[model samples]
Target: MKKLIACVLTLVLAVSAVGAMAEGLTFSWWGGDARHEATQAAVAAFTEATGVTVENTYSAWSGWEDKMSQYFASDSAFDVNQVNWNWLFSFVDGEGKSKMYDLNQVADIIDLTQFADAALAQCTVNGELLAIPVSMTGRIFYWNETTWQKAGLETPKTLAELMAAGQIFAEKLGDEYYPLALGTYDKMILMVHYLECKYGTDWVTDNKLNYTVEQIAEGVQFIQDLEDAHVIPSAETLIGDGADSLDKNPKWMDGVYAGIWEWDSSASKFGAALSDGQNFVVGEYFTDIGEFQGGFTKVSLALCIANSAADKQTAAQLIEFLLNSDEGARLMNSQRGIPLSAKANALCQTEGLLDPMVAEANGKVIAWCKNGLDPQFEAAALKNSDGVYADAFDGLSYGDYDVEEAAEVLVEGINEVLGA
Candidate 1:
């Protein structure tokens, strides 16, 4: 009877030990279907290999930023997160303290040496390594060749040709087919790209607006000219489409919205959404856009561990596997942009795993865009849905604000955020 009791006690203790070792982590990110599927598969693989389970939450870009802001503010973020680079700066306190776990604590497991020092530097804040950068990205034009062909022209290689194609497209392919499309935020970024190229300066320097009121008005007018010339649909027309995103919009899928000033990292998602027989191609930076080549490259996204996580080492391990492991790298290839990890990049190039179009776009963005992005530029106050970018351009496009009035609103809003 004593031996029976002893055996029972042993079994109970064994089960308890198993339960203690079975802790799982929570991870979250925002992306399209391809990214969701790939990341889920990678998570499953990591779980199978290490018996470390992960629960993942994901959604498209629409409200993800606001949701993340809430999580971070409450100090209740998930164990791991796929973060926008600027979040490192945006989420910090006045003293520069961050809610991210100091990655130096988990250096024993993660291969930090795999990334470039310059790349890693951008992700650090207040002496804390806030995140691990996945890739660098910059905006460039991507065109649907089938749509351009319908207008009887090749994709434009110069700003003049691009503007000319707009009228030509309107004449030959009906008023519904536009040469390019720019949402409110898209216009904001493109304005910066235009101003940078023309003025040869960063949009923000030393936490102040670089352009004077008149210079900003000129930038706003340039966007207005595009709308007037039919280079892109007016705000009203695009809003009428009623699609959540350009990728889901019917006109884009059917080849009516032919060109986009989009991030290079987004090539696959956008291209895959096009109708069968349509071709998506990386386009050249127009030599005539400005006197100097402009635009800026930034850390497209990153992997981070929350300081509030119950298992910091486990979270770090997950990020390491997703970013640096052979299998993980294979699954995640070019989904987040070109890999910033030297090992992953070399492997992708040698094995031909990197998407050819993505590589081509990244090469062009890196070579021609000569400015560095300011972290404050992507602050939620400016870039979030229904934010200032909308306040300025939406009013301008709807004729509620003229060129000078729109510039006033834009400068005021930008300064408000920067000054804060």
Candidate 2:
């Protein structure tokens, strides 16, 4: 009987151990193959160190927003997932505020001070840290040094100089090479960049939503002129698809186009190409008017938090791990902007994975402006602005519309969007 009792006692201890090891966790994110591999490795490491069962949920960008909305609305959802920065305002601003976890509760689990001021500020609304910033982000000019030198033009610092360089590039490269490679389908993204050059601080401060009609007209005219001047490549000839231009042509690899405006991660493309004997460099932001002010900036990427969990403690642990761990920083590397955390930055340098330009741009990001505007307003302006480019490009190639009429039409469209 004693022998039977001993066996049963041993079995009880085994079952208890299994239960302890089964502590559940789930985290989701969107990215390509490399991000997936690195994130999985990080999770695996976390699990091995803590004996937790981590459920990884990840996908591409398409339909990611819809998936997140549904998950956030339902009870059966990931404990933590990646989100777009804009979504922070979407959720916390008016209606969706109540459905988030208080960062203070999990403060012991994660260190918030590690993140940069701008990134951290974006996550804070009404003095609450809604999400942790994993990376720094902004728009930047990426140029192919090889292509520019071949054209015999230095990198342009001002907008006027950029136009001159573009003409020279077009003259030399002829039809095969574009002075500036533009992702045509995504031209809407460029509208803000051009607007920044035209209006300066007024673009963000004076006319975030309420710009005078004349100002809008001026901004629209500026873009049309750039298109008319042949600075931007013809859409039909160069861009196959707007959404995936970076992956498809990878301007740095082609060695034909001079430069393109893109996000922080763009530098990595050049850096990656260099590993294979291709060389490139990141250029400073260029403006047409007075000293070039900083160009368009994105408010932030998504901040993630959990709604339901069997054990909030475990979920918090995982969140802290990804946000503050050196292993997590290396796993993501520069794939996500620069690390949002200063500690994360130091960790990356220690690992020899830091990108210098990205580090610099992260310092200049516009902060506390994540809210107080609507993207739909920007979208409307873009639709109207498109006409300016469409008319200019079509007229130049075919010689139909005169310069004055083309400029007038562009100005009119901007005025309409601005409600002037």
Candidate 3:
């Protein structure tokens, strides 16, 4: 009887040790309700299969950055988290730094080679592969086909054509509608697309504040012509008093604007609006010069590990599962952008999980910074183009800025930001 009791006790202790080894690991991410639901489902499945418990914390985008900052500053590090590709440098830099695990450790598990060149490129800083990008973003021009016809023009194929179309809409539509709806609240996003189209991604990336005065003048001139022709509508009218007016802007939903410069992932949102009484179609991406064939670049949303983790191996497993697994690709679908992994993309395609337009859009995009820019330099140079186009393109209504002056001010602003 005693010998039997001892064996049972040994079994009990072994079970307890196994359970202790499989304790819950926490992962934090910021996403909308739908993303949270899908991602949690994926996590639950992963937990059940691996016999590991996962604790997830999800939040809206506005406060997510602060949440991450606090986590980084805390005693207990966040095990795994979502990070914007642009913001990766901020975390990995500085003294007493957040160290990223080498990708080579899990190369076989994660399949890094499966990702697109553009997506992989963005996630790589220095020589280390610090993160796995969940999806890629591409810039595209979205236009209302019905509105274009009303303005007595076909879809503009190039920048000149777009400007010409805008002039026609201004003359024809007048007060009934604006030629194009520009987001005043999120002016930076629109500015980046336009600046890239106008100057090419290379010029914008490489020049930074050091861009010769001529380049600034050229960008300003492009904006001036568009504004003078009434290509972009009044920012105040569309944006009201805030910095996030794209969804709330009636002109866009009501089918009054000619087009929009937005990300490809945004197509579905606009498409849904179209189903609910809005008439529109996403047009081909147009540049100031022409259709920018080389302008194709992917903006990545990366999954990164915090330097302070109790179990780096656990975090790596989560990342690997998400990037390389079929379930993970479906969970990330529209929320992340487009999956960067070849297997993930293939599985999504096979399952019909990908939106056709998104796939089409991805085929054309390239890396945002093809020349491999320093993140700080990229941020500074990007600020040069950010809202300058808004003022340059819509200065007539503001009456405080114009194309030429806005151009000069933009150069000064960029130069100042870059400490040039």
Candidate 4:
């Protein structure tokens, strides 16, 4: 665990930090039903405690990224936002000016002592404290143990075994069954992970892509190899399934889609979606993916005050209350993963509020991933619903581009974002 070098208090504010506020603020986020419920409850409690009226706008994560992008561009963003780490680069300007407010302005109101300097550092841009991180996360494998048992195989511990199991599943369980499912952004993440393991390098370094066309072509081939092996469904099949996300897919819930490559923070939601008696177990990272071990962990989500907020202090108070207060901490539990705030984390520990599956997956992810993620790797232009990742993988899967051609398109599009 990273130690928090808590920001020291410089001023004793005269105003009551938790006092009633007259301004009505807007807050927005994206999550599953569980998170929405937990957060709304917390918001209600916050409102009761402090006379602040907060209007909430939240939705599923699917197209929420693009909608948030539009909100920022239109200068109509909510006063408080549940921001992803990459938004630091996505919403910032050419001169490094941030779209988020400098939290330092409300330092007297929010107890900055709850946040680690390291976590706070990732949310900073051009010396401005832009956002407060909620949790750290990395993608890890999760499998439906019951489905694997029915296939007469154990959860795969090696990449070769995983590909081989696809054949076994098909022969035994028929055409609709798959060992794993991945969407466009998931494929993008997996390809980079494969390359990083082979080359022993980060995906992006100093605003430039680290791999050449040929090297990336090899990664693209690996994705094609998975489809050929039936280890995962094609993009066309995933589209045909008509589910917005894997967790919401009937096939996944019923165990025909047996595994996922997903963020550790999401383990609970996915596990909860499975049919009764289906065992959802965390899987070991495949050691034979390449010559070296590789993956990256980053801030899972964060709270930010928009620069356009009508009342900055009130917005900061909502953040402070949600992350640092005992009432808010208990209500949130591990809905957002292990809290990055020391006070919240300690409270969860003492109250026994941690979700066992989420904690276990989180522990494995942080311990295994050996690289730092470049924020731009997940910038909206690259990871959004209809963005570069979707285009590259969709075109490849739909037969519009061969592996090499897809590599060219992927590289060109990434370069455009990096140069912008």
Candidate 5:
């Protein structure tokens, strides 16, 4: 009887020990190679320090939205998730509740003071701090100087110069080359910039379309003009090339596509894709376009804790380590753009971990942005799930619909999304 009791006690103690050491948490994110590598390193370092086990799920940008949507709907999302800034709006229901753990509730572990007020404000929905902003970003021009010089042209500083360079490229570099490469989403952003430049207004105001169908038609026409001038590749041509994304396209890597309007945070990946010795430079905003700056800046990505997480405290601790610790800052560097945490940003600077072009572009974009970004701007209805932006813009690009039809479709689709 004594031996039996002793054995049972030993087994119970062993189980308790295992439970104490099993601080398992799952983290999910989407990114390219650099971001994945950096994030894995950071997670490993955190695990080593805390004796916490972490399972990491990462992938490229493609299909992430649909995958995450399913996860959120099923309440099976990772304990810690990297979410788009705009997702907060859709993730919350009519009751203004979200499936995101309120970070403010875990403020003790996750150092909210490390972030700026503005950054924190962006993550708050219905008075709940749903997530923490990782970085601020805006789309801007990045040019391949090597390609431009080969075409015997300088980097363009104005819309007129950019248009002229298209003709120059066609003459100097042959029919296959274009001065710019833009995908469907890229076209939407560029069109917004042009419209804001021309009209001095925001894209949406108070959950409504700010521009009329006629004005939007003009924007679509401008995109057609660029395609006609050979300044940018046609949607049909890009689709026929069969590349999954612009970063993976051989044309972009080989300098056949000389310029991209991409997020400042994404500048490094695009630069890395170019051939060795190919120069990548940030181009100036078109000063001649308008009195107001044509671009908008907002949080690039946010770190959120899932409402269904089994261990909220452990998840919060992991977030703190990743966003506040000097070691985590060094490991992460600026792969997810610049860190939003003041302390992390300073640590990165002191450690010289920031990419120069990314840093410079971030500064330039912050200075040049004048408009407030809306969460609905990137709604799945507008951008992904048979999105209006893609349907109208791609139809126009493929010559299935002219400017007028595309404009009518765009306005109608946007209204359906906004319920206006």
Candidate 6:
């Protein structure tokens, strides 16, 4: 009878051990269906190997920043979070302490050496390694060849050609079609590109505005010129379409909005969204306007551990597997852009998983970009919350403000954000 009791006790301990290994963690991110599927599969594989459970919280990009901001502020974010590059500036305290985990502290579990030195450096803020950068990205133009052909125009290689194509498209395909499509934020980036090209200067330097108010007016006016020339749909028209984002807009999928200036990592989704037989091709930078490259490249997104995580060591292990290991890399592939991990990139290349167009575009942007980007350029107060860029540009688009007025408002709003 005593022998029987010993065996039963041993069985109970085994069950308890299994329960202990089943620690649960939460991971959050923003992406489309393909990313969601790949990430879920990765998580599943991780769980199968490690006996740990991970809960996923993900959605489209719209409103994700605000949601994560709230989560971080409330100390209620997931154990693992997919963070934007600029978030490092906002999430660190005055003394340069991060609100997220110091990834360096868990170096044993996480493989920092798998990433490039420059990529890793971008994640370091205020002496603390805050997160691991997943990929690099920059904005460049992409054209739907079928749409351009339908409008009886070749792919635009210069600013003049692009403007001319706008009129041709309007005449040939009616007012519904345009040579390019730009929303409020899109206009902001494109305006920066135009200003950089025209003036041969960076957008900001030393946390101060580099361009004069009048010069900014010229930039804003250029966007107005595009609208007046019918190069893109009006802001009012996009809003009326009632889509949550450009990618979701039926007009874009149908080829009505034919061109976009977007990140190289995002090329696949845009291409996938096109109708049957529509050809998507990366376009060259408009070199005629600028002697120097106007755009900048930076870490696309990062994987970070929340300060509030109950088990940081386990979290670090999970991140390591997802970003550094062959199996996890295979599952993730290029869904999060090109992987920053040298090993992961090599793995993808060996497997033929990297999207060719995205890979080429990424290389072009990296080679061409000559300017440094400011972290504050993407500050929530400036870009999204206060809608500084959107308000100024959308006002100009809707005729609520002229170029000068819009520029003044933009400068004042940006200064306010900087001061805060």
Candidate 3 displacement at residue 419 in angstroms: 4.2
Report model 6's TM-score to 2 decimal places. Answer: 0.93
- Tell me the tens digit of each residue's lDDT in model 3 across 1-97: 9999999999999999998887777888775565677789888878877877888988766656656766666645567877766666656545624
Overall lDDT per candidate, in order of appearance: 0.90, 0.60, 0.63, 0.89, 0.91, 0.88
Alpha-carbon deviation at 229 in model 4, angstroms: 1.0
**Candidate 4: misplaced stretches above 4 Å?**
1-22, 93-96
Estimate TM-scores for all models: 0.94, 0.74, 0.77, 0.91, 0.94, 0.93
Question: How much is 325 displaced in model 6, in angstroms?
Answer: 0.6
RMSD in angstroms, candidate 5?
3.4
Residue-wise C-alpha lDDT for candidate 6, range 50-125, written one tens digit per residue:
9889999999888898899889888898999999999887986556667799899999998888988888888888
Score candidate 6 by lDDT: 0.88
Q: Write the per-residue lDDT of candidate 1 for residues 1-420, one digit (tens) a residue.
A: 999999999999999999878889999999999989989998999999888989999999888988998999899999999999888887876667798888878889889999999899999886788899999999999999998988899999988999888889989999999999988888999999999899889989889788888999999999999999999999999999999888888999999999888999876788999989999999999888779888999999999998889999899999999999888888888888999988889888889999999999999999999987889888878886778889899999999999999999989999999993
Off by over 4 Å in 3: 1-23, 31-34, 73-77, 99-101, 116-121, 149-153, 167-176, 184-201, 204-210, 241-243, 273-275, 287-296, 366-374, 377-397
RMSD of each: 3.3, 6.5, 6.1, 9.9, 3.4, 3.8
TM-score of 4: 0.91
Candidate 2 per-residue C-alpha lDDT over 106-224 given as tens digits, one digit per residue, 9 for 90 to 100 = 87888877766765676676677767777645556666777777788777777787777766776887656655665532343455455554444434333334345455455545555
lDDT, candidate 4, 1-420, per-residue tens: 123322222122323343334458899998888899999999999999998888999988877877888888677899999998888767865666788899988989888888889888988888888889999999999999999999999999999999999999999999889999999999999998888888889988888888999999999999999999999999989999999789989999999999999999977889999989999999888889788778888999999999899889899999999999999999988899899989999999998999988888999988888878888887767786778888889999999999999999899999998893
C-alpha lDDT of residue 54 in model 6: 96
Q: For model 3, what is the alpha-carbon lDDT of residue 174?
A: 76
Model with the higher TM-score, candidate 2 or 4: 4
| TM-score, candidate number 5 | 0.94
Residue 213 of model 3 has an lDDT of: 58
